[model samples]
Target: MMKTALHSVSYAGVWPGQARLGLDDFLERTRNLGFDAVMLMAKRPHLSLLDYDADARSRLRQRLAGLGLKVACLAGYTDFCLGAERPDIPTRELQILYVRELARLARDLDCGLVRVFTGFDYANVSLDQQWGWCVTSLRECARQAADAGVNIGIQNHHDAAVHYESLFELVEEINEPNCKIMFDAWSHAPVEKAASAGFRQEGGDLVAAVKKLAPYLVHTTVADYVHRPRYRYQPNLINYICESDALRAVPLGEGFIDYKSFFKALKEIGFDGYVAYEMCSYLRGGGSEENLDGYARKFLDYLSAF
Candidate 1:
């Protein structure tokens, strides 16, 4: 059966006005919210490598066991192309080391997955070089994670492999058994919307895209969004210049995303994996404890149907 997990980013205070909860408190809240598992942000104010030592990991594992909450995955932030312009900085190596430590931490926490990202495109570097960096770095991360019995789940959040097809190709090129895809619907919803408006793009159909990636998908994150239009007033011409619509996060089942098709596809594939809910941006309602908890509960209610 599919399971529901809450991501700590929602309450990590990373976003403006979002309530920040300590790691322990977040875990307790997850249990209180009735989520089957929890996805840790794996950084400061939560599970920072510097803050969590060997003893800390032990205590955290025990706490989760006590709460009957499973660790779904550790969210690892990485950008392989971040310092491509300044190769002297060893950014790729540092990120690899960061992921390595995360793998060790995941092992210590008794978690089997560590979610990562490919790099964003840099102005000075060619896409080929950035792709190579991501592939090489992810391959190494996967090799190391394998030793710890952890898998590296590459999320389609960054520039590299942002498209589902490219993401699939990237994973295939990485060629690591332990490396898998952490697919999400919000990432593809925009593309599908664009495709409907005569924009050419792959994976425009959410169901087909999900089926295409179902074999490699090990984890997925759920979030809903609605586009808010923006325009720049051109006083000189007495007209307004249209700009891209700003996406605002909203409660599940309330946004423009077609979660019915997305979840239906996942069900068709028998994706019995973690479907994590994350509030990673400024939300529709204020980010108070009451609103956040209400959103979280609504997500559970939304998933109960599937």
Candidate 2:
């Protein structure tokens, strides 16, 4: 059966006016919210490597067991092509080490997955060079993570290989057994619609994308968003200039994402992994604890249909 997970980022204070929650409080809130699992943000104000020691890991593992909550995955932030111009900075090596340590932490916490991201496209960096950096770094990360019985999930959040087709090719190039895809509808739905239509469209071929990545898919993060059009006043021209639409987060099933079709495709592929809900952006309602909890509860209600 597919499980539901709440990402700690919902309470990480990354978005404007969102209140911060400590790790312990986040875990308790997740359990109280009726989620099957929790995705911990592996950074400051959550589960930073510098803050968690051997003893802390043990205590956390026990706490999860007590709450009947499982650690779905550890969110790791990385950009392999960050310092492409400055080769001496060793950015790639440092990221590899970070993933390696995250793998160790996952093992200690009894979690089996760590979510990572591909590199962003640098201004002066060639596509081939950036792809090579991600491939090399991921291969090493997968190799080390396997030793701890952890899998590395590459999320489709970065510029490089953001498309499902290119992301599939990138993963094949990495060619690691433990390296898998953490595909999501947020990025692809917009891209697919833009590529197909001359302008931005409402929905995309979520079914096809999910089917394509189903085999390698281990986890997925879900969020709903609505497009709010923006325009700049052109007083001289007596008109307004249309700008790109701004996406605003909303309660599940309230946005333009074709999640019904998306989830149907996952069921067809027999995807039984954790489906995580993340409030990583400015939400429709104000960032109060009551509003956050209400949004999270709505996600569970949304998933119950399928």
- TM-score of every candidate: 0.97, 0.96
Candidate 2, residues 1-306: lDDT per residue as tens digits? 579999999998998899789999999999999999999999999999999999999999999999999999999999988997788889988999999999999999889999999999988999889999999999999999999999999999999888888888889999999999999998887787576766644333888788788779999999989989999999999999999889999998999889999999999999989999999999998788889999999999999988
What tens digits encode model 1's per-residue C-alpha lDDT throughout 174-240? 9999999999889878877877777764445778878888879999998999999999999999999
lDDT for 94 (candidate 2)? 92
Off by over 4 Å in 1: none
Candidate 2: C-alpha lDDT: 0.91
RMSD of 2: 1.9
What's the C-alpha lDDT at position 205 in model 1?
A: 74
Q: Report per-prediction Cα RMSD to one decimal.
A: 1.1, 1.9
Give lDDT: candidate 1, residue 301.
92
C-alpha root-mean-square deviation, candidate 1: 1.1
